[model samples]
Structures are given as C-alpha cells and as structure tokens.
Target: MLNSTQVSYFTLGAYFDTKQVKYVLFLILLCLYVLIVGSNVLLIMVICVKRSLHEPMYMFLCSLFVNELYGSTGLFPFLLVQILSDVHIISAPLCFLQIFCLYTYAGVEFCNLAVMSYDRYLAICHPLQYHALMSLKKVALFIAAAWITAFLIVTTTTSLSFSLPLCGNFINKVYCDNYSIVKLACSDTTVNNIYGLISTALVVFVSVGLILYTYMRILKVCFSGSKQTRQKAVSTCTPHLASLVNFSFGICFEVLQSRFNMSSTPGAVKVLLSLYYVTCQPLFNPVMYGVKLSTIRSMWKRLFWVKLK
Candidate 1:
C-alpha cells in the first residue's frame, strides 16, 4: 500500500490505445476546446460591453458563460494532451487540482442554473417589481453567492480526497475524480463517504428544488395571466429549461458512471458518457442561448454585421 505521499502520480486506466487515430482525436478535441473558448468568451464580452444587456438575466448569463469557460478549460487542455501522450498519468497535485476544478465547475453550474431560474421567476411572475427585486446589486450578490457556495463545497471535497492515503493510484476514468480517489484510500473513508453523500444531496436537492419551485410559480403565472405573459414565459424559459434538462442528464450519467460498475459497457461509449457533461454543456449553452434569445440573437447579428463592415 502506497502512502499518499509515495503515490506521486495517478495512472488513468481508461485510455485505450488510440494509435493512428490519436491525431484525429487530438484535432477534434482541439477544435472543440477552441470553439468552447471562442463562443463563451464572445458571449461574455457581448454581455459585458453592451449596456442594453446590463439586466439581471444577462448578468446571470455572463456568469454562466464564464463558468462554461472555466469548466471546459479545466478538462479540454488536459484531454488534448492526454489524447496525444502515450502515458496517461497525472501528477498527484495536478490530479487533485483537476478534481477541484471540475467538481467546483459542476457545483457552480448547478447553482448558476438555479439562480437563473429564480431570476426568470421574478421577471415573469413579478414584472412590475422585477427590476426592484433583481437589481444590479442583488444580481451581483446572487452571482457571488452561487460561486462562493460551490467553491466552499468543492474545496472541502478536494481537501478530504487529497488527504487520503491511497492503496493504489490508478483511476479508472479519463480524468481525476474525487470519488475514485476515495475508493483508493488505504485508510477508512467513512468521513469522505458521509461528507460526499451529504454534499451531493445538499447541492442536488437545493438546486433542483429551487428550480422546480421557481418554474412552478412561472407556470402558474403563464396559465392565469394574459397571452403576452404566456409568450414571455415561453420565450425566456425555454432555453433555460433545455439547458437544465441537458445538464441534468449529463450529470446523472457521470454520477452513475463514477459510482457503479460499468465494466461491461463498451470503452468508447463509457468515454463518451464521461466526457458528455463537461464537453456538451459548455458547447450547448452558448449555442442554445444565442439561437433562442431574441435580444441576444439580434445583438450577435448586429455585432457580426459591424465586424463585417
């Protein structure tokens, strides 16, 4: 049994031999990383620079886009490198750091979505008081709270996983995972497991509960209110609903993959399932919002036209 200190590097057991296809995979992932970075940064810039988009919804979106960038950057670069490298090993500190980055990214993503749902509830259900309710200060505070809460949660998780003395350093996934690390512990993991369950429940239930509650209120308004009210709810809430559903599916798959034995599953499928949440959500949100939101669409078109001119 190797002590945590003796386990200087963790071998990722998931990467099979890519051989000649490695270059193709590398290029594909590189392009994906570039697109994720470019699209998200553009959206963030548009929101930040345009005074018309200074409202609470767009402010929350800016935070969401920023998180997409953060999360994608955490995985894509390492993935690109690993795809090309023969040795699929990550240093202990880097592994833990990746675990921290990706975990917090997931946490922040859920919390940000929850906050956006609340913002929508205010906009649709309380139009008259929406501005008063979701002022710039409150928006800032909400965004801060979302990010800070995720940071604190993932920080504790990563710290606990990092301190464990590992019997083995082989992770059966493409990237560093906190649960996988806990499973490698030579010492008792009662604390880690207990904390993991508590934190997971806290984040999932609270975020999902808030989203459900807000949407219920929004639906109530749409049903009883005028046609304009219904249209408003449909227009604003559709993209959010789509994003939430897509993200939830991805996270569910990831959680299942991490916790359960899926050894019988094909390697490629397993890899795709593991990468889906991190890759797809970031790619999905920008495109979804850009296409779905009229104001953002118009602004994006105008910006493109100006650039062309």
Candidate 2:
C-alpha cells in the first residue's frame, strides 16, 4: 500500500513481473522455511523428551534453537512474499514489530551463546565443583537472566530504531532490517549508527571474545592432563565450540561489511549478503547442533518419521 507522499524506489533484478519464476522462488523459500522450522522444533522436542539431554549445555543449545526460529521467522516469510509479489511496500507499525522480533531474538541468541560458553568453561576448567556450580536451579537462573537481558537490549534497540519518523518511505533491503530500515528515516541517523556500532562490538568483541578466552583456558587444561581427560573435554565442548564459530563468523562478517567496507555494492551483493543472514543462519544452527550431538540426531530422525525403536 503506497501512500501519495512516500517515495518508493524500485529494487533492480527482483521485479515480480514474471509469474513462473516468482512462483518457483516462492515455493523454494517456503520449503526452506518449513525445513528450518521443522528441524528446530524437532531439536526442541528431543531435548525435552530425552532424559539424556537434560543437562546445562543442551539446555543452552535448546534455547538457542528457539531463538533462531524467532529471528528467522521475523523476516524470511515476508521477504519471500515481497520477492514473489515484487512489491516492497511495508506499513510503518509492522516494520516496528519486525525490528522488535529481530532484535529480541538476536540479543537472546547472543546471550545464550555467551551463557553456553561460560557453562563449558566451568565444566571443562573445574571438574570437581562443576556439579555444584552448574546445578539445575543455577541453570534456570542463568536462563532467566539471559531473557531479562535480551528484553532490555531489545527494548532499547526498538525504542531507538522505531521512534524515528519515516518521511522517506522505502526500505532498501528485502526485509525489515536495521540498515535498510534506518536508511528510510526522515532524520539524521548518526546516533543510530553509533548504537549499531556499540551493539556489534558488544556481541562480537565483548561476548565472543570472553568466550574464546575461556575456551582457550579450558583447552589448556584439557591438553595438559591425561589422554582420556583431553578427549572428554573436547567431546563435551565441541558442539558448543562449533556453534560459536558458526554463529560468530556470520555476525563478524555483518559488522565488518556494514561498517568498514566503503565500496559501493551492487544489488546482487546486497541480496546475497542479506540471504546469508536469513537463509544461511537457520540452516547452520540445525546442522551444527544435530550433527555434532548424537542425541539431537536421534531426535531429528524421530521427527522426520525415522523409526528409532
């Protein structure tokens, strides 16, 4: 729905004039979204039902999957529709909701990763007091804290992101995104850009950096001891490590590409980069968690009608 006042720009290479190609792409995206939802839901179900997975580490991973579903669903479906229809119109209120959902999930995902990393650090570095320190009640408290922190971060980002007036109507990207959304605002976004920088630093530099430092210490402890201890440490933390690397790699790329790369990018590069966040992210989480953890794989098998009995 385009108003008389708002100026809408046509994004090249995605004109929805052709019926066949649009429908085909829509079908493909719908399948991918279904696959993502199904996989993450199965991951959650397996963790809940399987007695073997009721541990601190898997709990963190379960939360991560849930948040991933939240983040991906926020934009991917709408984006698919926009691309298929070749209409990029979005109402102002709906755009705010999109930012809220995306920011919440992203913040929660960051906190959950940090929490998992710390849990691994404790388990690997302190074999003796691990049980007492990472008890069920303590894990619950940590999750609660993560949720609260995520809420606050989301509140701040949303308040700032959405409060700006939208005199200029069009968002440049495929979905309701931070960069594209900000560019549509009527006012100067210097402060918003600064906040974006801070947010990126907080996630990539502060949270992941500390996690890496802890993992390094944990690795030191693992390699110094007996062979069995080394193997066990690697086994316990490997899934988490993989997830951290997989997740952080994309985020770091986003930060650098947005902030540092001063070159003028073409439309194809924009779509490809945006697809990394939307399409690649959901797929990565399931593969990393499901493949790395045997329990999750069994659950995933059961989910897809594979007989486990």
Candidate 3:
C-alpha cells in the first residue's frame, strides 16, 4: 500500500547467495571494469591526441568510446558494490538515477552508431563531398544532438516513472529499470506506457532506418565501384557492422527477458542475458574497433612501443 514517496528503498531480488564465491565474483567483475575503462580510455586518448585521426570518422569514434565509458560506469561500480554487500537494496533516488544513466546510455549508443554509419556512408559513397557533408562543426553538432536528445528522452522517461505511485519497492533485477518500476505502479500507467511506446518506436525506427539506409547506399556504391573502393568499404565497415549486430543481439535478449516471463529459464542464464547488453557492449566495442580498425590499432601499438622504449 506504500506509494513511491513512502518507498525509501528497493530490493533487487535478482542477486543470489553466492556464499564465499562472492569474493571471486567481486575480483572478476573488478578486472572487467578495469579492462573496460582502460581500453575505452585508451582509444579515446588515441583518437584525441593523434593529429591524423582528427577526422569526422575518428571524431565519431571518439564519441562512441566516450559513450561506452559512460554506459559502463553507470553499471559497473554499483554492480561491484552490490556484489559484495549482503543487502542488495538501493535507495529510491539512487535507483532512479541509475535508470536515468543507463537508459540515456542506451539511447545515446544507438544514436551514435546511426551517426557513425552516416559518416561512413558519406566517406565511401561520396568521397569528394564527405568533408563538406561531415565537417568538424557538423560532427560536433551531430554528437551534441545525439547526447542531448537522449538525455531529454530519458529525462521524460525517468520523470514519468519516478512520479508513479508504487505498490511495492522490489525490483526483480540487479539494476533499476523503467519498465520494471512502471509495472510496480499502484495507479494508472497508461501515460507511461504510451510515452514509452512512442519514444521507443521513434528512437528505434529513426536510428535503425538511418543505419539501414546508409548501409544500403554504401553497399550499392561498393558493388558498382572499383576493387579498391570495395576493399575500403569492407575494411572500414566490418567493425561497425559487427558492433551493430552484437549490440542488437544483446538488446534483443534484454528486451525479451524484461517484457516476457522467463521464470522457467535457468537463473544463471537469465542473469547473464540481462547483463549482456550493458556489460558486453562496453567490452565488445572497444575490442572490436581496436583490433578491426587499423588506424586505431597501429596508433595504440606505436604509443605502447614508444612508452616501452
């Protein structure tokens, strides 16, 4: 019978008794956090410091790396703390804040990818006009728009969920989620549901449409162009395509877990699937881009070698 205001904390029911293995879990997660932070920060620094990388593509990449860092930070530290503590409770305010951070991170991730695809499209399909189309100023604007729009959309989402009158304070997941909270509302969630549907549709459709359209155009150009052009397209677009597919799969798993009843599923598998998108994408993108993209790969290697000397 408690409303949201009366609900001081939320219990995260997803965590199980790891017994003494929590220490092992903690160490493993800590290493993962370090790796994610280190790899992403390294790429960001490389993109920013290298004068040769000061192009639209790298700039978009830098933004992507930054978002990976932002998104990972939203989850890892809190997750680390919860892993050790017996109590998996998060304060209502902190729960809302995490929702804001994570949701915004997701929104920005998709938008950023869409923007990068367009940048690639312009680079390969319209080489002469690439610079003009994706100038530094425009790149800056695109990055800003991606971030700002995500913030605004997630802001509305979080606010709507926060204002709901909750009948309970138990979230069945390891972290805060807007849908889970909305489902806990004692009052009507018609507005929240409507807005959620609309925002999700817009974000998904727009970002996916842009990515598909740009890739289609890029593919058309590649097929008709010279061998060198085809090679260039393959080289540049492989990592991006891989990244998009990987993230999409992770998101699909999460959405399915969230929206559907998966109680019959194994608990461990469910937990992993729930965390796959946020956890894997941060680690995945850095590795994929670092290894696949020669510019970043060579730059990081040269810098490491210089330091070794």
Candidate 4:
C-alpha cells in the first residue's frame, strides 16, 4: 500500500484491453457527443427566443435541456480525450472532481424530473389553478433549488471521499465514480457507504417515487376525463415519461452493476452498461422532448424554415 500523500494518480482499468478499437470508439463517441450538444443547444435557444413558449412547462423543459448540457459537458470532453490516449490515468484531484460533477449531475437530474412531474401534475390535474400554482418566479426558484441542493449533497459525498486513505490507485471502471473511489480506500468505508445510501435514497428514490405518484394521478384524471383530455394528456406526458424511464434505467443498471459482483460479465457488456447513463441520457432527453412536444416541434420548423429562406 502506498502512502496516501504519494498516491497522486489513479489508473482507469476499464479501457485497458480496447486499444485496438480506440479510434473507432473515439469517432463514434465524438459524433454522439456533438449531436447531444447541438440538439440540446438548439432546443434551449428556441425556448429562450420564442415568446409563445413562456410557460411553466417549457421553463422546466428548458432547465432539463440545460442540465443535460451541463452533465454531458462534465463527461464527454474528458472521455473523448481518454479514448485517443494510450494510458488511462487521472490525477487524484481531477478524479474526485469528475466524481463530484457526474454525481451532482445525477442528483440534479432527479430533482429536475421531480419538479417537471409536479409541473405536469399541476397543469393536467388542476388546470384551473395551473397558472397560479406555477408562476414564473416559482419556477425559477425550483430550478435554482434543484441545482443548489444537488451541489450541497454531492459536496458531502465528495469531501468524504477526499478524506479517505487510499490503499490502491486502480479504478476498475472507465470513469471516476463514488463507489469505485471508496472501494480503493485502505480504511473501512462504513461512513461513506452509509452516507451514500442515505443520499441515494433521499435524492434518487424519493424523486422517483414522486414522479410515479404524479403520473398515477395524471393517468386517473385522463381516464375520468373526456377523449380530448385524454389525448392532450398523452401528448404532453409521453415525452416526459419516456425521458424519466430512459434515465432511470440507465442509472439503475449502473448502480446494480456497481453493487454486485459481475466478474463473469463480458468486458464489452460492462463497457456498454457503464456508458449508458452518461452518454445516452444526454442524447435522449433533447431528442425526446424536441420531437414529442407539439409546440416545440412547430416552433422548430418555423425557425428552420425562416433561417433557410
């Protein structure tokens, strides 16, 4: 075991055996990253410029788009660089910082989705009071709270990780993750583990529960209401629900892989699972929302048509 002070770098072992296909993987990821950024930015710009979209639901959608950009920026740039490099090494500070950004991204995602669910619940279930319930000021506050709370919560986890006396420097995965870092610690990580559970339950599980509750209520109202109401609800709710399920699956799969012993799992499978959350969600959110939401789609068409003309 090396002294904690002497261990300034950690080696990433997930990319160890993929040297032969690094360039191929690099090109694929680069294109995907560009698409995620381009699509997200375009949607965000449309929301900001179009006065017709100045509503609570679109506000929440804007926040979601920006969050996707934030999360992907934290990861894709570093990942692109690593894909072309021979060695997969990260400094200790950078490793922890990456963990902080990525973990905070996940937490903020849950919060944003929870808030969006609330927005939809208000809009559909209590249409008469939707405007009063979700004013512009209130929406801004919710977005701010989502970002601030995530930072504070992840700050605790990252600080705890920084204090650990690491006995090893090899991280078995591609990116820096909370559990992976803690697993390398020389000392017992009881506190980190307990704190991790508490944070996950508080942030991920609670938000997921809230989203499910909102959807349940929405569904009930849809069934009780007329056909037009049902159609409207389906049109609005489909994209949000799809985004939620996509993100939840990615996060859950990564968590399950981390918690269990999957040594027998093929390396290729492991790589795919690891990349799912960071890569897919960023790309998925913009595409889902931009195409599914009617207002955004119409606005997009007009914006492009005018640009071309």
Candidate 3: segments with Cα more than 4 A from true spot: none
Better of 2 and 3 by TM-score: 3
Taking all chains together, each candidate's TM-score versus the true structure is: 0.98, 0.85, 0.98, 0.97
For model 2, how does the per-residue alpha-carbon lDDT over 13-106 read when each residue is reduced to its tens digit? 2233546777777787888889889988878878888888899888887888888798889977777768666456776667667868876776
User: Candidate 4: global Cα-lDDT?
Assistant: 0.89
Worst ten in a row by lDDT for model 2: 7-16
lDDT of candidate 2? 0.72
Number of backbone clashes in candidate 1: 0
Model 4 lDDT per residue over 129-204, tens place? 9898899999999999999989999999999988888889998888888898888888989999899899989998
Candidate 4 residue pairs that clash? none
Per-candidate Cα lDDT values, in order, are 0.93, 0.72, 0.92, 0.89
lDDT of 3 by residue, 1-309 (tens): 788889999999999999999999999999999999999998898888899999998899889889999999999999999999999999999999999999998899899999999999999999998888889999999999999999999999998988899999889999998899999999999999999999998777899999999999999998899999999999899999998898889889999999999989987788899899889999998899899888888998899899999
Error of 1 at 23 (Å): 0.3
In angstroms, give how far residue 303 of model 4 lies from its true place: 1.1
